[model samples]
Target: MTTSNGSSGLFISFEGIDGSGKSTQARMLAQALEQDGRDVVLTREPGGSPGAEEIRALVLQGDPDRWSAETELLLFTAARRDHLERTIRPALAAGKVVICDRFADSTRMYQGLSRGDLRAKVDALHELMIGQEPDVTLLFDMDPAAGLARAKSRATVEERFEDFGVGLQEKMRAGFLALSQEFAARFEVINAARGIEDIAADVLARIKARLP
Candidate 1:
C-alpha cells in the first residue's frame, strides 16, 4: 500500500532506530511494489543521490565524535537537499513510487535528540532547505535492547550512528513515536518486533489502502 503525497506519485519512507529492520523492510517494500508492476524507486539517506552519498560517507565513518552535533546537522541537511533534488523529486515527477530507507526524521531524531534541545534547529533547517515530507512514513517500533543487539552484529563503517548504544536507541524510539503524533497524517506505527514477513505484509496492506 502506497500513499500519494498529493503529487504525481507516492513518496514512502521507512523510519526507526537502527536495527529496527526498516532498511530490510524498505528493500522488501520496493521489491514487492515492483513485482506488483508498479514503478518504484528504492533509495536511502543521508545518501541517495551521488553527491549526497559522498556526504553520507563523511558523516557515517570515522570516530564516533568525529563531528559535533551542529556540524553533523549541517552535513545531514545538505545531504537531504541533494537527495530531494536529484533523486526523490524526479522519481515522483515520473509518477514512480519512491521508497527511502531513512529520511529527514533520522536527522531530527539523532540531532534533535542530542543535547540542548536541538530539534528546533533541525526543524528550522528542514523548513528552510528541504520543505517536502513523505506521503507515508512507516515507523518500525521495537525494543531498543533487541535493536541495539542487532546493530552491534553488523560489520560496517556505518556503525558511527548505531554505536551510540542501547540507551540512545530507547530515546530514538521514543522520538520516532513522538514524530508519529506530530505527523500523524502520514505516519504508520508498525510493530517491528513481529516476524519480518508479517511486518511486511502489514505494511503492504496499509500502503495499498492508500494508493491512488
Candidate 2:
C-alpha cells in the first residue's frame, strides 16, 4: 500500500453495486475501528451534507431520459464537492478515520460503463473537483442478478439504479472490476457472497493491516 503524507487520518471508501452490502460493511468496519479506540467517521456520497442530500433527491428521482449524461455528471460532482468540503475533509483533518459508503469511484463506473462517450469528460471533471482520493477502497464483488435480488429484498422503495435492467448492472459490475485492476493497491475487491459478519471481518482485517 502507498504511504499517505502528514498526520491526517486515512480516508477509506466502500464501493459496489446497489445490493453488494457496502453500507453494512462500511458501518461494521467503522464500529470495529472505533471499538479498537481509533477515531472514525462514517458518511455516504450524494447525501452526506444537507446540500448534497437535496441534490441527491433531485438526481435520483428525476427522469433519467430527461437528463443528459453531462448534466448527470455535473450534478453528482456538485454534491461531491459539497460533501468533501463540508463533511469528509473536516473529519479527516482532525485525525479521524473516514469510512465513506461510496465516493467518486461509483460515478466513474456507473457513468463510464453506462454512457461510454462521456467517460473522458467525467474523468476530467473528477480530477478537477475531487483533489484527494481515498487511501483504500473496498469493492464488494457479486453477481448482478444476485445483487439486485438482495437489494430488492431489503429496499422499501426502488431507486434509479434498482430500476435499471440486468444488462446495465452487469456492465457496471465489469466496470468496477476493471477499475480494481487499474488501481490494485488502492482497490481491494472482496467476494460479497458470504455472510455479513464474515465479509465485515475480512474488511476489518484489511483496514487494520493498512492503518498507519
Candidate 3:
C-alpha cells in the first residue's frame, strides 16, 4: 500500500508547516540516496506533474480567501490525482525512491483542519481517489512563530497559505503534531529548528533504516 500498487520502491514524504525546512530536507535526502547509488525520483504535490502544476498556480498564487475551503479541497485532490498518475506511481513502479516534499497529510491539515472541520471530507476524498500513503513521513516540527517568520521572508507567489498569518501556523503546527500521533507508524517527528546539515543527517539515517 505504501509503495503504490505493491511496487518495490520506497515512498518517502516530507511534511511540516510552512518554512519548517521539510523541502530542503526532502531534496537533500533525495540527493543523498542518489549518491548512494539508489534510483530516486524527487517530486512534490500540487505541482508535481504538468496538470497538477497548472492547478497549483490557481490554488497557491491567489488571495487567501480566493477559494472556499471545500473548493480548495477538490482542487487539491484533483492535482494530487494527476500527480499520482503522471509522477509518483510510474516512478515507484520503476523501482525508484519517490521523495515528495508534501503529500495528503498537508491537505489533511490545511484543508481538513484549517478553515473548518473538513477532515472527514478530506479522508473520504482520499480513500475514494488517492488510496496510497507514504511508507515514511518525516514531520519537521518547529516553533510556529519562527516558521511563519521564515515563510514570510521567502517572498514567493505561493504566499497564499503564509498570508493566513501566525495564528493559522500555530493551529497548523498543532494539527500536524496530532497527525503524527494519528499516523504514528509512518510519522517521524524531527525537531526542525536546527542546522540544515544536522537535520539532513538525521533524516537520511531515519530514512535509510526504513528503506527496503
Candidate 4:
C-alpha cells in the first residue's frame, strides 16, 4: 500500500457481507496476533478516527435512501481520508499490524449496487483518491441468506445497509467474490459456514504466512 507517511507493518483488511462473521474473525485475528507477541491495531471503516466516527454516524444513522450514492461515496471517502491520515498510517509506520474491518471493497459493492451501476466510478474514484490496498485481505465467503439472518439478529442503529435484505446481500456477496478474483494476490477466501475458531485459525495461518 502507498502513502505519504507509509508504514512498514502489514495492512490487513477483513471483508465480507454484513453477516459473514468477518468482524469477529478480524477481532480474533487481532487477539491471536497480540498473543503471538506482535503489535496489532484493530479498527473499522467509516469510523476509525474521531472525525471518521462523526462521519460514520451521519452516514449510517438515517434512512438507507438518505443520501444519493454519489453523496454517500463522497462522505465515505472523507471518512477514509481521516482514518488513513490519523489512524492507519501511523500504526503502520510504528510497525503495528492494522486490521481494518471494512475497506474500499465495501464501497465497491455497497454503493456500486445500491445506486445502480457505479462499479467503474468506484474504481476510478478509489484509484484517484485511495490508491493503496491491504497487503492481505480475508474474505469470509458464505451464503448470503445465512449471513443476513445473522445480521438481522444484531441490535444496532446501523441497519441502513442491512435493510437491503437478502437479494441485495446476494449481489454484494457476488461482488466481493469477483473482487477476490481481481486481486487474487492479496485475498484469502475463507469458509465462514464453519465454526468461529476454525475460521479464525485459517485467518491466522494466512496472516502468519505473510508476516515476515
User: For every model in order, what is the number of clashing pairs?
Assistant: 3, 0, 0, 0
> CA shift at 75, candidate 3, in angstroms?
0.2
Q: lDDT tens string, model 2, 1-212?
A: 22362446899999998889999898899889999999998999877999999888877774446466677788899999999999888887788888998898888877765755677877798888877789999999999999988887875533666677677778889989999998898999999999998998899999988897
Error of 2 at 185 (Å): 1.5
Ten-residue region with minimum lDDT total, candidate 4: 1-10
Poorly placed runs, candidate 1 (over 4 Å) = 1-6
Please give the RMSD of candidate 2 to the true structure.
Answer: 1.9
> Which candidate gets the maximum TM-score versus the true structure?
3
lDDT of 1 by residue, 1-212 (tens): 33355567999989998889999998998899899999999999989999999999999998888998999999999999999999999998878999999898888899888433799999999999998899889999999999988988988878987777777888899889999999999999999999999999999999898777
Clashing pairs in 3: none
**TM-score of every candidate relative to the true structure:** 0.96, 0.94, 0.97, 0.95
Flag regions of model 3 displaced more than 4 Å.
1-5
- Candidate 4 at 159: error in angstroms? 0.5
Residue-level error in angstroms, candidate 1, position 191: 0.5
In Å, residue 73's CA in model 1 sits off its true spot by 0.7
Q: Which is superior by TM-score, 2 or 3?
A: 3
Give a tens-digit lDDT track for model 3, residues 1-212. Answer: 34434888998899999999999898899889999999999999888999999999999987899999899999999999999999998988888899999999999999999877999999999999999999899999999999999989989989999999999999999999999999899999999999999999999999889887
Reference-based lDDT, each prediction: 0.89, 0.84, 0.92, 0.87
